[model samples]
Structure formats: structure tokens, C-alpha cells
Target: MASYQMLVKDVIKRADILLEVIDARFPDETRNNEVERDVARSKKPLIIVLNKCDLVSKEKLEETKSRLSKIAPTVFVSGKNRFGTTMLRHKILETAGIKGREILVGSLGYPNTGKSSVINGVAGKHKTGTSPISGYTKVLQLVNAGSRIMFIDTPGVIPFGENDEYIQGLLSVKDATSLKDPIGVAMKIIEKLCAENKTALESFYHITIGGQDSYDALILIGKQCNFLKKKGEVDDTRAAVRIINDWQKGLLVI
Candidate 1:
């Protein structure tokens, strides 16, 4: 954790501008407030790049953009579908407000937030390697983004002692098999889906959530999938893992 903090601070000091890449579905949760404060202290222009916009709805994106714009110049980007990359490029130059000399842009975000994908999208090529697993970028690499803009791609930043299983599970920072409390995390995911998009959750699981809380919904899903134990009881752990896997894979949208 200390190493990550040092890496992020070093990148922030070296770069001309900074891009805080966050998950578009859970912008608030994925954002690193401490890093933002460091960027603030350094007085560097920070652009909030909301990646994975394709996984979220337009209305939600607009709402998130409006709220986050108050803090920094926010841009919605879908690195998967190559959407909003042009807007992101324009926004980066517009935020920097400099020309002639190359602009060193530093990218920061939590694990699995699509920092590499965003970089690739903006560069219009696969300049940096990307993976679905978290903490894939181990070292900082500089890539030419053209237009007098260069990118300093840094590793994902997570604060020290940030061991919340639910946040990690939701952000794909930890895979379903990696989590110790998969059932608890899946219940939280169900509650979030129930609150935000119950219809999508129901449709994806093929179960009616009428009056059923997160636990009941989980059991029902297990029953439907025939994930059962010796006594025909629902195998909750397997069901929970399935739910988390589906959520991380973008199959269950909220």
C-alpha cells in the first residue's frame, strides 16, 4: 500500500495533468479520495474519466457526470466499445490548456477500472496491455498519445487497509473465488441491484423478487439453477459465486 501511494505521488509530480479513471457503474465507490487530495495538493488539473460507460445507462451517466464535474473535468468513456475516446482526447487537451510542448498525462484509478483500456482507446490502438484481472499493470510506462500528449500509465491505487470485501467484489478487484465471504458480498450486490434495477436483476436471474430480500433472492436463484446440496438444500456458496461472476462479467447490468 505504501508503495502504491509512492508510485501514484511520483506519477502525479511528473505529469503535466492527471486522469482519475473510475468505474462508471460505481463511480463514488471506485474513486480514491486520498489520491484526489494529493492531486489537489499538487495543483494539477485532474480529469475524471468514467470508464465502462457501456455497462451503465445514459441517464445514470449524465447524473454521475453532473455531480463529478463539480470536482474536475469529467468525461464518460467506454473503452470496450471504443466510445467517447475522441471526446476524452479533446477534453484532455482542453483541460490542459497548453500546446507546442508535449503534455505528460498521468492515469490513476483503482484495480480493474479500465485504465489501460482507456489509454488504448485514447491512443486509438492497443498500446498498453489490459486484463480482466485486477492489478495487472505492475510498472509505469509512458506511451505517446499523439497531439503533443503523452500518457504515464501507473498501477491502480487502493488505500492502505481497504479490505472491504463487498467493494472489492463489486469492483472486480477480487474475483469470486478470491473472496472469503462470497455469500455476504453477493447479498450486498443483490441489495444494490434490488434498489437500483430490480427488473434487470430479476430478468437476469429468471426469478421473481416479489417481497424477497437479498437472501431469499439468492436461495431462489440457487434453486432455479439446481445448485443443491445433499438434502436438496440450496448450495448458497455456489449460487453466490455465480451471482458475483455474472456481475463482474457485465452480464447482470444495473
Candidate 2:
């Protein structure tokens, strides 16, 4: 927790404007208390960037957008492909309405949600090192986005402490698998998806495991997906990773 304070607290408090980036595919996951606390404390204008729209289904994207509308101005942008990024910039400008304001905009999101990539894309060159590994950006990085747009980039937030409702929801939607054992996290995801998104699951797998317990469904998914060890025992970690990747990529939309 103390280590996290350096990254989350220090960086979040310093920003004058906050651009909370969330994976567009999973709105529930983006509802982070750390960011929420930051926003509340700072009381600065915030623009929500639903990054990685290209990977999520249209229906899911729409659902995420609707949910986010209540929070702040939201934009869907693909940092990798540069899709919908211009609109994001435009929205940021409009939301800030800060004429000659030295706005400190923080690119915030969970790990692997493409914050560094988006910053580099917006900067029109390689700025921060983007990688598949989680928590790569350890210290807060500031990128030049021309005049009036100084961007503060921070490390991805993965909840570490006990069950906080917001953290639970964030872990669920954001695919925060790296925070804990992947298998346990995957089981949680499968159960939540089974209850909340029947159509999406069916669209992906053509089967329903709504009647089963969360752990049972996880085992079934692991078996079906062939996430097994040498002894033919369920490899919870492997199974969890598979399901989480599928869910994040919209491959499990059945």
C-alpha cells in the first residue's frame, strides 16, 4: 500500500486536469476508487477516455458509453490504430474550456489498457515505452502535447487491499488478473459475465453456465478450453488467463 501511494496518490494529486482512461470493453472495471478519490480531492475537470474501442463489440461499447455518460464526458479512442482519437482531443479541449490554462492532464487507466500507447499516439511519435507487461510505467511521466496541454501519465492501478465494492467492480470489468492469482480472478469474471451478460456469453461460447456456481463454471470453462496441467488437473491460472483474454478481446461474446 505504501508503494502504491507513491504512484497513485502522488501522481493523481498533482494533475490539474484528469483524463481517466478505461478499456472501453469493460466500463464496470474503470470505476476505480483511487481515481474517484483523486477526482474528488482535486475537483478538477475530468474527461473519460474509453481507450481500445476497436477490440470491444459495438453493443458492449454502447453499453459502456451509456454507463459512463453519468460520470463525465467520455470518448472512445483506439490508441493503437488512432481511431476516434481526434474526437477525444476535441472533447478534452471542450471539457477543459481552459483558455491559456496550464492544464495537467493525467492519462489514467488499469494495466495493459493502453495509456502509454495513447499518449505516444497523441504526441505523434514514440514517447513512453508501451509493452504487454503490467505496471511498466512505474513513475509519473509528463508528455508535451503542444501548448496548453501538458499530459501527466501514471502507472496502472490494480487494487491490492481487501474487498472494497468499487475495487471489486473495477477488478471485474478491467480484467485486473495480474493483481491476484489469474485462475481465481478468471473464476470471478466468468461468474459475473454469466449473470450480467447472458447474450454476450452465448454469442461467444453458445452455452449458458448461469445455473452453476462461479467456481464450478470456472472449472467447466477450464475443461472446455483445455486449461489443464500434466496430470490432467485444472490449471486455474492458465484457464483464468484464457477466459480473461477472451473476454477482454470480445471473443467470448457468445
Candidate 3:
């Protein structure tokens, strides 16, 4: 079990080509600047796989690609639907070209970016363990994508001292089970989602958010979900955790 830093270094060293997975909704936020520097130092062909593209609008996806292209070769992917696996595979083959028939493809991303699912799609199976929680994969686990490609799943590389409660919660890098202020972080998610599209959030959750602040809306959601404690008190923690999990799972959408 290598530490995250050492594990990331191993990923950079082993993989001939790297896929840096970022959430389609918050590509900029999910991206790790340190990982970018490490990839640059490794001099590997780095591809940016915007995971969960299905949740984002076509316009936003295009905008993201336009900006992200400046950072690396970008590809849109919906790991759940396996929507862009063919394109991903092709780009990888093209990038890793000619030197050898067999190529190792590894991924780097902050937590909950669906890196494992994306690579599983690349391999055409549910070969990797994927969860909404952070830090699932502990080390590089090699799986054969085919005769030509060895796919590697690396432990998610998150930065230290992520002071922003909202960022930490949304990215799911912080241990939600141990979070002292789940409702606070959940409010951040609510604020962001509401600011983006209150209608979408309302429609998805089947809860009217009209004139309600994020805190109040979350309590309402807890009620809607029938998550209550003794004396019929709405369980704020349950609702908040559910929201964060849904966001991570892409069920909440972009």
C-alpha cells in the first residue's frame, strides 16, 4: 500500500499514456494542478477524459473541451453508458502508436471522478470496483483491456489541506462519514446546483425549491425521502450525505 504521492508517481512512471479524469460538471474544480505538473514531468501523452459528460449539456461540454484542450488532449466520456469508450480507445491507440503493440494506460484524477468505471468501459466490463466514496483504489491494479492495452487503476490523488468545506464535500475527498458539518457541506452543493439550475434540481428530486434557502430545502428533502429521526425530526445528515452521494454518482446530474 503505497502512500498517495508515491502511488501517483508509480502511475506516471508505468503508464505509457495517461488519462486524467475530471468531472464534466466541474472540470476546473476536480482537476489537480499537482497531477498536471507530475504528468508534464513524466512527459507521457496525457489525455483529459471529461467523465460524466452525459450529465452536462452539449454546449457546456463543447465549452469545457475548448478550454481543456489547451491543457491536454481532451475527450468526452460517459463511463456509465460507455458512450465514448470507442473514441477513448482510438485516441489511446493513436497516442500510444507504433512503439509497441502493447500499451499501458493509467488514470489520474481527484476522488469520485469515475476513473475506474471509465477504464472498466475501456476494457468492456465491470472489472474494477467503483464507489461514490473517496479512496477506494489503494494502488495500481492492472487489468488487460485487450491484447494491446493494459489498463491501470491508480489510487485517486487528492491535495492536502482542502480548506473549503464545499469543495471537499463536493469532490468527496473528505470522509463524509466523519464530516462534522455534513449539512453545511450539503448546503454548498445545494447552492451550487440551485445557482446552476433550480428547475433541474427540483425536477430530479421532486421537491419544489421555490423561495427556500439551501438549508431549508435540504430539510424538505429529508422529509420527502422519509428520512426522519425520533419524534419525526428530519435527518439532516442522511439527506446531506444522500445529496453528496448522488452528486458523486452522477444521479444528481450537472
Q: Give the winner by lDDT.
A: 1
lDDT per residue (tens digit) for residues 1-254 in model 2: 56655566656666676777776656665557667677767777777888878766677777778778888887788889988866766777777788866666766667666787777667664233322222334655677765466677666655434644324433344454554666666666676666666566655654557577777776776777777899999876766677777765556541
| TM-scores, one per candidate | 0.91, 0.69, 0.77
lDDT of each: 0.86, 0.66, 0.80
Give the clash count for model 3. 0
TM-score of 2: 0.69
Task: Give me the runs in candidate 3 sitting further than 4 Å from their true place.
Answer: 125-139, 159-168, 171-178, 205-213, 216-242, 245-249
Candidates arranged by lDDT, highest first: 1, 3, 2
After superposition, the stretches of candidate 1 with alpha carbons farther than 4 Å from their true spots are 125-138, 159-162
Candidate 2 residue spans exceeding 4 A from truth: 1-14, 100-102, 125-139, 157-159, 162-182, 206-210, 222-241, 245-250
lDDT of 1 by residue, 4-48 (tens): 887787788888999999998888888888999999999989999
For model 2, the run of ten residues with the poorest summed lDDT: 126-135
Which ten-residue region of model 1 has the weakest summed lDDT?
A: 128-137
Model 2 per-residue lDDT at 132:
29
Best by TM-score: 1
